[model samples]
Target: MDQQFGEQIGNNLEVYMDYLFIKSVEEDHMLRDTVDTFQQLWKIIMKLNLRKCSFRMEEGKFLWVIVIKDGFKANPEKVQAISLIPPPISLKEVQKLKARLVAINRGRDVAQNPNDTEESIWCFLCEAQLYGAAEARKQFLEVGGDPRPVMRQAYNMFKDGGDPEKLVDAFSKGRESEYFYASLYAGLYYESQNEADKAKVHIVASCNSPYGQRSDDYMASLAKVHCMCRNWEL
Candidate 1:
């Protein structure tokens, strides 16, 4: 983490702990207990003077550990000190840093399209958008480059006056992973047509199409539809 950002993290944690302590407790005893524990923890963190932190890859995911000055490991006991420490830098931040580093450190390819057949450039562009690469994302979408070809095809089929129900049918036969996004778009299309029932059906189907990146968020939004309407299950 950069020195500037670390300072911001330390400040936020201190404020968060304070906020938690001041919030109502009588109405929610559990809240009070949790706040108390965090207050104690924050005190310990303040004592430890934390410095650099690194994220290590474990089981295809990232885990962060703080490295204090002079080979000391920042632990829970160093609550107050840790509280003063900034939040652990996220992988998303790391990727942004990497992109910036590449832009500055590596030579640019002026060539229209370099020969990198091994890598799916479109997918890389998708990853860029997913990682908050706004400029690249704008360029990618501006060129009508849809990384998700399956969804694009389905949409084209719809634009060509294809049957909406059949569009849903076609996507239902897609890979389970594709079903959620496809259904999400399909749901929107149906909803616009005043087909609330069909829209609900497609939205619920997408939510059930194997939980993925935006799946939980989508499903949570549709929870009322699920509970109230008792719509399609799986």
Candidate 2:
């Protein structure tokens, strides 16, 4: 079904399992693109459950999480459930609490840090590692502070097949001046995936960043990335 839809609509639509998302580069083309998408679906006799559908929404729930125009967020109901759980008194109850904490942290936006001090944040990062909190780890790396332990952890995670897309998404949410390390990591991930075009964009961005310009390691990595991309003008 996805193949058929892609054949018909090309880049104008995307299918994820049973869900379909229609996109257009220009606002004026949105209605036309949607109509074209529907026409292809109609030709295949694809029936959409309208109750499960929304259009032109700025924000909505998908896969049990809330997605806003800016980024993803935890579902309110899930947060409420976690909040309502009583304090743990037994081993089993402590395990349940741990599970709930993992779930809450998984859904949280990485950029929002409740901790203030470096020591506290490092403690949180260590706890995040213990719980496999990939989002937290990625965000901490992006925020850029004292880099020794955090960078080592990030390297370990990358070696263990951590998703690069999370770092890429974090890069998009960060300020330009704050994105040097995020861009570098994202570029490395894309490079590892054999995506030179995507890799070059981030690598070049990192090379131009103030932080990147000051770091010899970043400069070396940037040169290697440029060479890989066959961009000799660097």
| Most accurate candidate by TM-score | 2
Estimate, for each residue in 53-108, the C-alpha lDDT of model 2 and write its tens digit: 88887677654467665656778988898879899898557755775565455423
Q: Cα RMSDs of all predictions?
A: 21.3, 15.2
For candidate 2, give the lDDT. 0.56
> In candidate 2, residue 112 scores what lDDT?
34
Point out the worst 10-residue segment of candidate 2 by lDDT.
Answer: 107-116
Each prediction's number of clashing residue pairs = 14, 0
Which segments of model 1 are wrong by more than 4 Å?
1-143, 157-161, 212-234
lDDT of each: 0.41, 0.56
TM-score of each: 0.30, 0.35
